[model samples]
Target: MNLIRPDKIIVGMIHVDALPGTPNHQLSVCEIARKAALEAKLYHDEGVDAIMIENMHDTPYLNKNADHEITAAMTVIAHEVKNAIRLPVGIQILAGANKQALAVANAVDLDFIRAEGFVFSHIADEGMMNSCAGELLRYRKNIGADKVKILTDIKKKHSSHALTADVSLLETAKAAEFFLSDGVIITGNSTGEAVEPSDLAGLKSEIKLPVIIGSGISNENIYTYWNQADVFVVGSHFKLDGHWTKGVDPGRVQKFMRTVHSLRQ
Candidate 1:
């Protein structure tokens, strides 16, 4: 958990395209791995603090454990990206496959995993996603992978929080901290959307763990959250045209890093 210092750390996202067995599957596993490695290199060269590889294109994501093929493919891609870049790398399996992501992180010697549905139940695109803090921590312990930090999403994107409507986002973050999460992720309604500073401030005051902004960061808005957020998880803005599905744009990455560095000084 202390691996990342409490600064405006920038964690780039390598949104790996659909793996085999998913509905959107297209490229061969090797091709996908190559592309991921390339993106990892780009992030490293651009001085990104860390990078997280996710199975974002694997549409129609599962609410439970992912298939063996999906896990295997992610492992392969992660391994390649790990070798390609010196920056710390992490993994996040779509929809709430926390255990699978942990297993992959363990196998690839990754620094961490981005877990969804870590605190409360909510309706995600895949289905009703349940909390995994208890089960996930136990599994991480059983496997002796305590070195792998779990940065969980509280009130995660692409989900409805009607079930936990009575509770506040700050309380949800407190629950995550109580569960011993390495850090807590805050995000907008969906991918590529900007996180509200008020929401970021709310969670910052409530939890002692690292408060990471999980989406919608760019050179344009980085100044706003530069001092408020501990870490920024950027994906869409790094891509060409600021779309998650597009290839990484080196210029965008360079611009973002420059701005972040200036703020640090």
Candidate 2:
């Protein structure tokens, strides 16, 4: 079966609450899981094509590796979310924790993962991140999780790409495709920022893999990327008041899905 639809795929993000290891840890793991499951149900009910649970609230993220506690906590939350929704579920551990995210997806029987630092070396807020497509794919093979698709980000957000300024975005995307990424995501400079329409157009024109719009999608500007992008991963806009840290607003989700449905027609 296809992992996602042939038309525009709408993925809603569940910014999971601060896990135990992070500085912002306030709620118990059970509480956090409950909240995540509720958000997943909200997205499923509101007509999202898929749901991605992320450890976005884990500030001061560890570079490239998540602690065992973070992984265990995420597993619990991911299980709860999987039970709550029938739509395709995915996970992303912040700061390039692709392996842990894959482990969680494998355990929870998730469909996909949003991986960062998959192809090129760049300076992220967490520090310098190098390409991991080789090691990550090998790990996936070892763990027997090849069924879980890896949708990678090229020149991802919250990073400095000056070291690779000589490389164009298309070249970066080609590298990812060459490295065996299932799909490629294009994002803006940071969270909640709009992606350049020209960049989206350029990449779509050249790349044959699935092209995902990873940030800054909303009811107002969905038209700009309607035809060029295969998937739209929305987070901040679905929350209360368009803030990433707030709870999922049902009204906002309904409104946005309505717009997407109209576009699909």
Candidate 3:
């Protein structure tokens, strides 16, 4: 069965609280799981199509290869959130922890994962990120988690793409397709920034893969990219005051879903 339907999907983000071992860590694993599940429940009640749990608050993230504790903490939180909501759920570990995210997803029976640096190289705030399509997919298969979809970010946010400046966005997307990415994500320069509509249009016209709008989708502008995107990964817009670091506001979610529902018709 295709987990990501052909119809437009609105994936709400559950920014998992600071996990143990991270500098901002304070909450116990159980407490973090409780908070995440609460947000998941809210998203479900508010009519989101799916949920994506992320360790966004785990500041000063490792460039790659998250520690065992981080992985363990995420596993607990993902499991709890998955149980709290019936919608398709996914997870993303910070700073390119694709393999760890996959392991957690596989263990928790998650529907998918949002991966960074699935193809090509880029310099992120965390550090250099290299293509991991081959190893990541292989690891998925090896772990018997082929059922979990890997949605990758191309020209990821909060990073400089100067290293691949010679390569056009379309070329990078084609490369991802060539490497067998389940889907390719398009994002702006930083978090909560709106993706250029023309960029989504370009990929939709040329690529056969599902094109996901990864950032800056708000209730107001959903109409602009509605026709072009297959999936909208909304985070900040649904949070209180449109801030990623704040708690999710039920009112914001309802308002955004209202716009999305209208677009679906």
Q: Per-prediction TM-score, please? A: 0.97, 0.98, 0.97
Best by TM-score: 2
Query: Could you give the C-alpha RMSD of every candidate to the true structure, in order shown?
Result: 1.2, 1.0, 1.1
Clash counts per candidate, in order, are 0, 0, 0
Query: In lDDT terms, how accurate is model 2?
Result: 0.92
Global CA lDDT computed for model 1: 0.90
**Candidate 1: which stretches are off by over 4 Å?**
1-6
Model 3 agreement with the true structure over 71-139: per-residue lDDT tens digits? 999999999999998999999999899999999999999999999999999999988889899999999
Worst 10 residues of 1 by lDDT: 1-10
Q: lDDT of all the models against the reference?
A: 0.90, 0.92, 0.91
Weakest 10 consecutive residues, lDDT, candidate 3? 1-10
> Please, what are the lDDT tens digits per residue for candidate 1 over residues 1-265?
3534645688999999889988889999999999999999989988998999999998888777799999999999999999997888999998788999999999999999999989989999888988989999999999999999999999888889999999988899899999999998889999999987888765666668888899988899989987677889999999999999999999999988988888888
- Which candidate ranks first by lDDT, i.e. highest? 2
Candidate 1 to truth, TM: 0.97
Tens digit of lDDT per residue, candidate 2, span 41-103? 889888888999999999999999899999999999999999998888899998899999999
